[model samples]
Target: MIVNLGDQLFMQLQLRGTIWTQTITNLRTNWAVNFSIDLLGQSQNYLYFRIEQYGSTFVDDAVYLNSKWKFARPSNQGCTLAFRGIKDFVSTPQLSADGLSCSVVKIIQRAKENPRPGF
Candidate 1:
Protein backbone atom coordinates (compact mmCIF):
# COMPACT_ATOMS: atom_id res chain seq x y z
CA MET A 1 0.00 0.00 0.00
CA ILE A 2 1.26 3.51 -0.86
CA VAL A 3 1.94 5.71 2.16
CA ASN A 4 0.78 9.34 2.50
CA LEU A 5 3.26 12.22 1.91
CA GLY A 6 3.15 13.13 5.61
CA ASP A 7 4.10 9.59 6.64
CA GLN A 8 7.04 9.57 4.17
CA LEU A 9 8.25 12.92 5.48
CA PHE A 10 8.04 11.67 9.06
CA MET A 11 10.04 8.58 8.15
CA GLN A 12 12.74 10.76 6.56
CA LEU A 13 12.90 12.90 9.71
CA GLN A 14 13.27 9.80 11.85
CA LEU A 15 16.18 8.59 9.73
CA ARG A 16 17.82 12.00 9.94
CA GLY A 17 17.34 12.08 13.71
CA THR A 18 19.02 8.72 14.09
CA ILE A 19 22.04 9.89 12.05
CA TRP A 20 22.20 13.17 13.98
CA THR A 21 22.05 11.37 17.33
CA GLN A 22 24.87 9.06 16.34
CA THR A 23 27.02 11.97 15.14
CA ILE A 24 26.53 13.95 18.37
CA THR A 25 27.22 10.88 20.51
CA ASN A 26 30.42 10.11 18.62
CA LEU A 27 31.63 13.70 18.94
CA ARG A 28 31.04 13.71 22.70
CA THR A 29 32.88 10.43 23.21
CA ASN A 30 35.83 11.49 21.08
CA TRP A 31 37.54 14.72 22.09
CA ALA A 32 39.83 14.46 19.06
CA VAL A 33 36.94 15.29 16.72
CA ASN A 34 35.64 18.31 18.67
CA PHE A 35 37.89 21.04 17.33
CA SER A 36 38.50 23.42 14.45
CA ILE A 37 41.34 24.13 12.03
CA ASP A 38 42.44 27.37 10.38
CA LEU A 39 44.41 26.97 7.18
CA LEU A 40 46.86 29.81 6.33
CA GLY A 41 47.54 29.57 2.64
CA GLN A 42 50.93 31.02 1.70
CA SER A 43 51.96 33.08 -1.31
CA GLN A 44 52.10 31.58 -4.82
CA ASN A 45 48.94 29.66 -3.80
CA TYR A 46 50.94 26.54 -2.98
CA LEU A 47 48.88 23.93 -1.09
CA TYR A 48 51.39 22.03 1.09
CA PHE A 49 49.27 20.59 3.86
CA ARG A 50 50.68 17.53 5.66
CA ILE A 51 47.67 15.68 4.17
CA GLU A 52 47.62 13.71 7.44
CA GLN A 53 46.50 13.94 11.06
CA TYR A 54 48.47 16.30 13.32
CA GLY A 55 48.71 14.62 16.67
CA SER A 56 45.30 13.37 17.94
CA THR A 57 43.53 16.41 16.35
CA PHE A 58 41.66 15.90 13.08
CA VAL A 59 42.37 19.01 10.94
CA ASP A 60 45.60 21.00 11.48
CA ASP A 61 46.13 24.79 11.72
CA ALA A 62 48.95 26.57 9.95
CA VAL A 63 51.23 28.16 12.59
CA TYR A 64 54.63 29.65 11.88
CA LEU A 65 57.15 29.41 14.73
CA ASN A 66 60.62 30.84 14.63
CA SER A 67 63.70 29.00 15.85
CA LYS A 68 64.97 32.17 17.54
CA TRP A 69 61.63 33.70 18.61
CA LYS A 70 59.96 30.63 20.08
CA PHE A 71 57.88 30.86 23.34
CA ALA A 72 54.53 32.26 22.13
CA ARG A 73 52.38 33.43 25.06
CA PRO A 74 48.89 33.17 23.69
CA SER A 75 47.45 34.22 27.08
CA ASN A 76 48.94 37.69 26.61
CA GLN A 77 46.66 40.50 25.50
CA GLY A 78 45.92 40.45 21.75
CA CYS A 79 47.93 37.23 21.46
CA THR A 80 46.24 34.12 20.16
CA LEU A 81 46.88 30.86 18.36
CA ALA A 82 46.38 32.71 15.06
CA PHE A 83 49.51 34.73 15.84
CA ARG A 84 51.65 31.88 17.09
CA GLY A 85 53.77 32.10 13.99
CA ILE A 86 52.55 35.42 12.57
CA LYS A 87 55.83 37.08 11.62
CA ASP A 88 56.98 34.32 9.30
CA PHE A 89 55.29 35.22 6.04
CA VAL A 90 53.31 38.35 6.89
CA SER A 91 55.85 41.05 5.99
CA THR A 92 56.74 39.40 2.70
CA PRO A 93 54.76 36.64 1.04
CA GLN A 94 56.92 33.70 0.09
CA LEU A 95 56.67 29.99 -0.59
CA SER A 96 56.91 27.75 2.50
CA ALA A 97 60.42 26.43 2.92
CA ASP A 98 60.83 22.93 4.33
CA GLY A 99 64.36 23.79 5.38
CA LEU A 100 62.88 26.01 8.12
CA SER A 101 60.10 23.56 9.02
CA CYS A 102 57.44 25.80 7.42
CA SER A 103 54.90 23.00 6.96
CA VAL A 104 51.79 22.79 9.18
CA VAL A 105 52.71 19.37 10.54
CA LYS A 106 56.09 20.53 11.83
CA ILE A 107 54.62 23.59 13.54
CA ILE A 108 51.96 21.57 15.38
CA GLN A 109 54.40 18.81 16.25
CA ARG A 110 56.80 21.35 17.70
CA ALA A 111 54.07 22.67 19.99
CA LYS A 112 53.42 19.19 21.40
CA GLU A 113 57.14 18.53 21.87
CA ASN A 114 58.26 21.91 23.15
CA PRO A 115 60.97 20.96 25.66
CA ARG A 116 62.82 18.49 23.54
CA PRO A 117 62.89 20.39 20.25
CA GLY A 118 65.82 18.30 18.93
CA PHE A 119 63.72 15.18 19.26
Candidate 2:
Protein backbone atom coordinates (compact mmCIF):
# COMPACT_ATOMS: atom_id res chain seq x y z
CA MET A 1 0.00 0.00 0.00
CA ILE A 2 1.04 3.59 -0.51
CA VAL A 3 0.68 6.31 2.13
CA ASN A 4 0.97 10.02 1.64
CA LEU A 5 3.24 11.76 4.08
CA GLY A 6 2.48 15.22 2.74
CA ASP A 7 3.24 17.43 -0.21
CA GLN A 8 4.77 15.21 -2.86
CA LEU A 9 6.15 12.62 -0.42
CA PHE A 10 4.74 9.12 -0.31
CA MET A 11 5.68 5.78 1.20
CA GLN A 12 5.29 2.30 -0.17
CA LEU A 13 4.82 -0.63 2.16
CA GLN A 14 5.21 -4.32 1.43
CA LEU A 15 5.18 -7.61 3.21
CA ARG A 16 6.60 -10.89 1.85
CA GLY A 17 6.96 -14.09 3.82
CA THR A 18 8.75 -13.15 7.04
CA ILE A 19 10.00 -9.76 6.04
CA TRP A 20 8.17 -6.41 5.87
CA THR A 21 9.63 -3.40 4.13
CA GLN A 22 8.72 0.24 3.55
CA THR A 23 10.30 2.53 1.03
CA ILE A 24 10.10 6.28 1.15
CA THR A 25 10.28 8.13 -2.13
CA ASN A 26 10.36 11.80 -3.12
CA LEU A 27 11.88 12.80 0.19
CA ARG A 28 15.42 13.66 -0.83
CA THR A 29 17.23 13.71 -4.09
CA ASN A 30 20.61 12.62 -2.79
CA TRP A 31 19.44 9.63 -0.79
CA ALA A 32 17.34 6.52 -1.17
CA VAL A 33 15.45 5.51 1.96
CA ASN A 34 13.77 2.38 3.29
CA PHE A 35 13.41 0.07 6.25
CA SER A 36 12.83 -3.60 6.92
CA ILE A 37 11.18 -5.16 9.95
CA ASP A 38 11.24 -8.84 10.89
CA LEU A 39 8.04 -9.95 12.56
CA LEU A 40 9.65 -13.16 13.68
CA GLY A 41 12.95 -12.24 15.22
CA GLN A 42 14.16 -12.74 18.78
CA SER A 43 15.14 -9.11 19.07
CA GLN A 44 12.19 -8.01 17.02
CA ASN A 45 15.04 -6.44 15.16
CA TYR A 46 14.42 -3.95 12.36
CA LEU A 47 16.54 -1.93 9.97
CA TYR A 48 16.10 1.58 8.57
CA PHE A 49 18.50 3.35 6.35
CA ARG A 50 18.91 6.33 4.10
CA ILE A 51 21.46 5.34 1.51
CA GLU A 52 23.31 8.54 0.70
CA GLN A 53 25.03 8.69 -2.65
CA TYR A 54 28.65 9.69 -2.56
CA GLY A 55 29.91 10.15 -6.09
CA SER A 56 28.96 6.69 -7.38
CA THR A 57 28.56 4.74 -4.14
CA PHE A 58 25.80 4.63 -1.56
CA VAL A 59 26.48 4.63 2.18
CA ASP A 60 24.46 3.31 5.10
CA ASP A 61 24.12 5.92 7.87
CA ALA A 62 21.54 3.56 9.38
CA VAL A 63 18.84 6.12 10.06
CA TYR A 64 15.17 5.15 10.39
CA LEU A 65 11.66 6.53 10.40
CA ASN A 66 8.66 5.49 12.50
CA SER A 67 4.94 5.45 12.03
CA LYS A 68 1.72 5.12 14.03
CA TRP A 69 0.94 1.91 12.20
CA LYS A 70 1.70 -1.25 14.15
CA PHE A 71 1.51 -5.02 13.74
CA ALA A 72 1.20 -8.14 15.89
CA ARG A 73 0.15 -6.20 18.95
CA PRO A 74 -1.62 -9.24 20.35
CA SER A 75 1.78 -10.82 20.52
CA ASN A 76 3.57 -7.71 21.76
CA GLN A 77 1.41 -8.17 24.86
CA GLY A 78 2.35 -4.55 25.61
CA CYS A 79 5.74 -3.96 24.06
CA THR A 80 5.47 -1.71 21.02
CA LEU A 81 5.92 -1.17 17.29
CA ALA A 82 5.87 2.59 17.49
CA PHE A 83 8.24 5.45 16.91
CA ARG A 84 11.86 4.29 17.16
CA GLY A 85 13.21 7.14 15.12
CA ILE A 86 16.71 7.52 13.66
CA LYS A 87 19.52 5.60 15.26
CA ASP A 88 22.43 3.31 14.51
CA PHE A 89 20.79 0.10 15.68
CA VAL A 90 24.01 -1.81 15.03
CA SER A 91 25.81 0.19 17.67
CA THR A 92 22.60 0.34 19.69
CA PRO A 93 20.35 -2.70 19.78
CA GLN A 94 16.89 -1.46 18.80
CA LEU A 95 14.75 -3.53 21.14
CA SER A 96 15.12 -5.45 24.33
CA ALA A 97 15.08 -9.26 24.30
CA ASP A 98 12.86 -9.10 27.39
CA GLY A 99 10.32 -6.93 25.60
CA LEU A 100 10.34 -9.18 22.54
CA SER A 101 10.28 -12.28 24.74
CA CYS A 102 6.87 -11.31 25.95
CA SER A 103 5.61 -11.58 22.42
CA VAL A 104 6.68 -15.23 22.28
CA VAL A 105 4.94 -16.08 25.51
CA LYS A 106 1.87 -14.25 24.35
CA ILE A 107 1.86 -16.16 21.08
CA ILE A 108 2.14 -19.51 22.82
CA GLN A 109 -0.50 -18.61 25.34
CA ARG A 110 -2.88 -17.36 22.69
CA ALA A 111 -2.46 -20.60 20.76
CA LYS A 112 -3.38 -22.59 23.80
CA GLU A 113 -6.27 -20.34 24.78
CA ASN A 114 -7.70 -20.16 21.32
CA PRO A 115 -7.00 -23.39 19.52
CA ARG A 116 -7.67 -23.57 15.79
CA PRO A 117 -10.99 -24.90 14.59
CA GLY A 118 -9.36 -27.81 12.81
CA PHE A 119 -6.14 -28.95 11.06
Candidate 3:
Protein backbone atom coordinates (compact mmCIF):
# COMPACT_ATOMS: atom_id res chain seq x y z
CA MET A 1 0.00 0.00 0.00
CA ILE A 2 1.02 3.61 -0.58
CA VAL A 3 1.94 5.16 2.75
CA ASN A 4 1.38 8.86 2.18
CA LEU A 5 4.11 11.10 3.54
CA GLY A 6 2.09 14.25 3.85
CA ASP A 7 1.09 15.39 0.34
CA GLN A 8 3.46 14.76 -2.52
CA LEU A 9 5.81 12.25 -0.91
CA PHE A 10 4.80 8.70 -0.06
CA MET A 11 6.44 5.32 0.60
CA GLN A 12 5.58 1.74 -0.21
CA LEU A 13 6.63 -0.73 2.46
CA GLN A 14 6.02 -4.43 3.01
CA LEU A 15 6.54 -6.19 6.29
CA ARG A 16 6.17 -9.87 7.13
CA GLY A 17 6.59 -9.93 10.88
CA THR A 18 10.30 -9.26 11.48
CA ILE A 19 11.40 -9.06 7.85
CA TRP A 20 10.48 -6.19 5.55
CA THR A 21 11.29 -4.53 2.23
CA GLN A 22 10.51 -1.21 0.67
CA THR A 23 10.75 0.42 -2.75
CA ILE A 24 10.40 4.07 -3.58
CA THR A 25 10.79 5.34 -7.11
CA ASN A 26 10.83 8.86 -8.43
CA LEU A 27 8.20 9.26 -11.10
CA ARG A 28 9.77 12.47 -12.44
CA THR A 29 13.29 11.07 -12.52
CA ASN A 30 15.18 7.91 -13.34
CA TRP A 31 15.95 7.26 -9.69
CA ALA A 32 14.85 3.98 -8.16
CA VAL A 33 15.39 3.39 -4.44
CA ASN A 34 15.10 0.05 -2.69
CA PHE A 35 15.65 -0.98 0.91
CA SER A 36 15.27 -4.01 3.10
CA ILE A 37 15.41 -4.76 6.79
CA ASP A 38 16.03 -8.17 8.27
CA LEU A 39 15.26 -8.46 11.92
CA LEU A 40 15.61 -12.22 12.13
CA GLY A 41 18.46 -14.76 12.24
CA GLN A 42 22.10 -13.77 11.74
CA SER A 43 21.26 -10.70 9.67
CA GLN A 44 19.08 -9.41 12.45
CA ASN A 45 18.23 -5.73 12.32
CA TYR A 46 20.40 -5.18 9.27
CA LEU A 47 19.19 -2.31 7.09
CA TYR A 48 20.37 -1.85 3.51
CA PHE A 49 19.46 0.20 0.48
CA ARG A 50 20.44 0.41 -3.17
CA ILE A 51 19.92 3.11 -5.74
CA GLU A 52 19.73 3.00 -9.52
CA GLN A 53 19.47 5.61 -12.22
CA TYR A 54 18.38 4.92 -15.79
CA GLY A 55 18.62 1.23 -14.94
CA SER A 56 22.30 1.74 -14.05
CA THR A 57 23.87 1.78 -10.61
CA PHE A 58 24.75 5.23 -9.28
CA VAL A 59 26.73 6.07 -6.14
CA ASP A 60 26.09 9.55 -4.92
CA ASP A 61 26.54 11.46 -1.66
CA ALA A 62 25.51 10.39 1.85
CA VAL A 63 22.00 9.33 2.92
CA TYR A 64 19.95 11.24 5.42
CA LEU A 65 19.77 10.07 9.04
CA ASN A 66 19.50 11.92 12.42
CA SER A 67 16.87 14.45 13.48
CA LYS A 68 18.54 17.32 11.62
CA TRP A 69 18.81 15.20 8.45
CA LYS A 70 22.51 14.61 8.69
CA PHE A 71 24.49 12.82 5.98
CA ALA A 72 25.57 9.20 6.45
CA ARG A 73 28.11 7.87 3.96
CA PRO A 74 27.48 4.76 1.90
CA SER A 75 29.88 2.05 0.83
CA ASN A 76 32.58 2.83 -1.75
CA GLN A 77 31.74 -0.16 -3.91
CA GLY A 78 28.38 1.29 -4.91
CA CYS A 79 25.27 2.93 -3.45
CA THR A 80 25.07 0.36 -0.66
CA LEU A 81 23.21 1.96 2.19
CA ALA A 82 24.23 0.25 5.42
CA PHE A 83 23.51 1.16 8.96
CA ARG A 84 26.30 0.79 11.53
CA GLY A 85 24.48 0.96 14.82
CA ILE A 86 23.44 -2.56 15.67
CA LYS A 87 26.18 -2.81 18.25
CA ASP A 88 24.56 -0.18 20.40
CA PHE A 89 20.91 -0.98 19.87
CA VAL A 90 19.24 -1.23 23.25
CA SER A 91 15.65 -2.28 23.82
CA THR A 92 14.23 1.21 23.57
CA PRO A 93 12.62 3.59 21.12
CA GLN A 94 15.07 6.44 21.83
CA LEU A 95 17.88 4.88 19.80
CA SER A 96 17.90 4.36 16.04
CA ALA A 97 20.07 2.03 14.03
CA ASP A 98 20.60 4.54 11.21
CA GLY A 99 19.63 7.58 13.17
CA LEU A 100 16.28 7.06 11.48
CA SER A 101 13.02 5.41 12.39
CA CYS A 102 10.20 3.67 10.51
CA SER A 103 7.62 6.10 11.88
CA VAL A 104 9.52 9.20 10.82
CA VAL A 105 12.11 8.67 8.14
CA LYS A 106 12.38 12.40 7.56
CA ILE A 107 11.40 14.56 10.47
CA ILE A 108 9.24 17.59 9.76
CA GLN A 109 9.39 20.66 11.93
CA ARG A 110 6.12 22.09 10.66
CA ALA A 111 2.68 20.65 11.18
CA LYS A 112 1.35 18.28 8.54
CA GLU A 113 -2.13 18.93 7.24
CA ASN A 114 -2.37 15.41 5.91
CA PRO A 115 -3.00 12.39 8.09
CA ARG A 116 -0.15 10.15 9.14
CA PRO A 117 0.31 6.77 7.50
CA GLY A 118 -1.03 3.69 9.30
CA PHE A 119 -1.29 -0.06 8.90
Candidate 4:
Protein backbone atom coordinates (compact mmCIF):
# COMPACT_ATOMS: atom_id res chain seq x y z
CA MET A 1 0.00 0.00 0.00
CA ILE A 2 1.19 3.53 -0.77
CA VAL A 3 1.04 5.74 2.33
CA ASN A 4 1.84 9.44 2.43
CA LEU A 5 2.38 11.78 5.35
CA GLY A 6 -1.27 12.77 5.73
CA ASP A 7 -2.88 9.35 5.42
CA GLN A 8 -4.45 7.76 8.48
CA LEU A 9 -3.96 4.06 9.09
CA PHE A 10 -4.43 1.30 11.64
CA MET A 11 -1.63 -0.36 13.59
CA GLN A 12 -1.57 -3.78 15.26
CA LEU A 13 1.26 -4.33 17.68
CA GLN A 14 2.19 -7.69 19.17
CA LEU A 15 4.81 -7.76 21.83
CA ARG A 16 7.10 -10.76 21.95
CA GLY A 17 6.15 -13.49 24.43
CA THR A 18 2.69 -11.92 24.77
CA ILE A 19 -0.28 -13.94 23.62
CA TRP A 20 -2.44 -10.91 22.85
CA THR A 21 -1.73 -7.96 20.60
CA GLN A 22 -3.13 -4.45 20.87
CA THR A 23 -5.04 -3.07 17.90
CA ILE A 24 -4.69 0.65 17.45
CA THR A 25 -6.98 2.25 14.90
CA ASN A 26 -7.13 5.71 13.39
CA LEU A 27 -3.40 6.06 14.12
CA ARG A 28 -3.36 9.20 11.95
CA THR A 29 -0.72 10.36 9.47
CA ASN A 30 1.89 11.22 12.04
CA TRP A 31 2.65 7.52 12.57
CA ALA A 32 2.83 6.41 8.93
CA VAL A 33 6.33 7.62 8.23
CA ASN A 34 7.16 3.98 7.47
CA PHE A 35 5.20 1.17 5.85
CA SER A 36 2.09 -0.47 7.26
CA ILE A 37 2.95 -2.98 9.96
CA ASP A 38 1.00 -5.84 11.50
CA LEU A 39 2.79 -6.18 14.85
CA LEU A 40 4.59 -3.22 16.45
CA GLY A 41 4.70 -2.05 20.05
CA GLN A 42 7.00 -0.98 22.89
CA SER A 43 6.65 -1.95 26.50
CA GLN A 44 9.39 -0.18 28.42
CA ASN A 45 12.97 -0.37 27.33
CA TYR A 46 12.46 -2.10 24.00
CA LEU A 47 11.05 -1.07 20.60
CA TYR A 48 9.79 -3.37 17.83
CA PHE A 49 8.60 -2.47 14.35
CA ARG A 50 8.05 -4.26 11.07
CA ILE A 51 7.98 -2.71 7.60
CA GLU A 52 5.78 -4.22 4.90
CA GLN A 53 5.64 -2.08 1.79
CA TYR A 54 5.33 -3.06 -1.85
CA GLY A 55 7.83 -5.87 -2.52
CA SER A 56 10.07 -4.94 0.41
CA THR A 57 9.93 -6.20 3.99
CA PHE A 58 12.18 -5.36 6.91
CA VAL A 59 12.36 -4.34 10.54
CA ASP A 60 13.70 -0.90 9.49
CA ASP A 61 14.64 0.54 12.87
CA ALA A 62 15.20 -0.38 16.51
CA VAL A 63 15.67 1.82 19.57
CA TYR A 64 17.19 0.53 22.79
CA LEU A 65 16.88 1.77 26.38
CA ASN A 66 19.90 4.01 25.86
CA SER A 67 18.11 6.01 23.15
CA LYS A 68 20.07 4.44 20.31
CA TRP A 69 18.74 3.98 16.78
CA LYS A 70 19.88 1.31 14.31
CA PHE A 71 18.91 0.48 10.74
CA ALA A 72 18.88 -3.13 9.60
CA ARG A 73 18.53 -4.70 6.17
CA PRO A 74 15.37 -6.51 5.08
CA SER A 75 15.21 -10.24 5.64
CA ASN A 76 14.64 -12.95 3.03
CA GLN A 77 10.86 -12.66 3.18
CA GLY A 78 11.15 -8.89 3.28
CA CYS A 79 10.28 -8.92 6.97
CA THR A 80 12.57 -8.47 9.97
CA LEU A 81 12.17 -8.40 13.75
CA ALA A 82 14.46 -6.81 16.32
CA PHE A 83 14.81 -6.49 20.10
CA ARG A 84 16.72 -4.02 22.28
CA GLY A 85 17.00 -2.77 25.85
CA ILE A 86 16.09 0.81 26.83
CA LYS A 87 14.78 2.95 29.63
CA ASP A 88 11.21 2.69 30.76
CA PHE A 89 8.82 5.60 30.48
CA VAL A 90 5.13 6.24 30.99
CA SER A 91 3.33 4.85 27.95
CA THR A 92 1.19 7.47 26.34
CA PRO A 93 1.33 7.02 22.52
CA GLN A 94 3.04 10.04 20.94
CA LEU A 95 4.72 10.79 17.63
CA SER A 96 8.02 12.55 17.27
CA ALA A 97 8.54 15.66 15.14
CA ASP A 98 10.21 13.56 12.41
CA GLY A 99 7.57 10.87 12.72
CA LEU A 100 10.22 8.22 13.14
CA SER A 101 10.01 7.31 16.81
CA CYS A 102 7.27 7.22 19.47
CA SER A 103 7.63 9.12 22.72
CA VAL A 104 6.79 7.83 26.18
CA VAL A 105 3.89 9.14 28.26
CA LYS A 106 1.11 7.91 30.47
CA ILE A 107 -2.07 6.66 28.76
CA ILE A 108 -5.49 6.95 30.35
CA GLN A 109 -8.59 5.32 28.88
CA ARG A 110 -12.14 6.11 29.96
CA ALA A 111 -15.50 5.02 28.59
CA LYS A 112 -18.28 7.45 27.72
CA GLU A 113 -21.17 7.17 30.17
CA ASN A 114 -23.65 8.38 27.52
CA PRO A 115 -23.52 7.25 23.94
CA ARG A 116 -24.18 9.70 21.10
CA PRO A 117 -25.63 8.56 17.81
CA GLY A 118 -24.27 9.86 14.54
CA PHE A 119 -26.15 12.80 13.08
Each model's C-alpha lDDT? 0.24, 0.36, 0.35, 0.32
RMSD of 4: 18.3
**What are the RMSD figures for all models against the true structure?**
19.6, 16.0, 14.3, 18.3
Writing each residue's lDDT as its tens digit, candidate 4 over 48-87 gives 4322245643222211121222213322311112321232
The lDDT leader among the candidates is: 2
TM-score of each: 0.14, 0.27, 0.27, 0.22
Tell me the tens digit of each residue's lDDT in model 2 across 5-87.
23234456677776878786765342447899887644343323233333533122222333222344333333433333232
User: Which 10 consecutive residues of model 4 have the lowest summed lDDT?
Assistant: 110-119
Residues 72-107, model 3: lDDT tens digits? 332222212223232222121132345444322332
Candidate 1 global lDDT: 0.24
Q: Itemize residue pairs with steric clashes in candidate 1.
A: 64-85
Residues 1-119, candidate 1: write the lDDT tens digits.
22222221111011222231111112223322222223333212121212133354323233333311111122121212233222222222222332222212223332232211121
Clashing residue pairs in candidate 2 (N, C-alpha, C atoms within 3 angstroms): none
User: Against the true structure, candidate 3 has what lDDT?
Assistant: 0.35
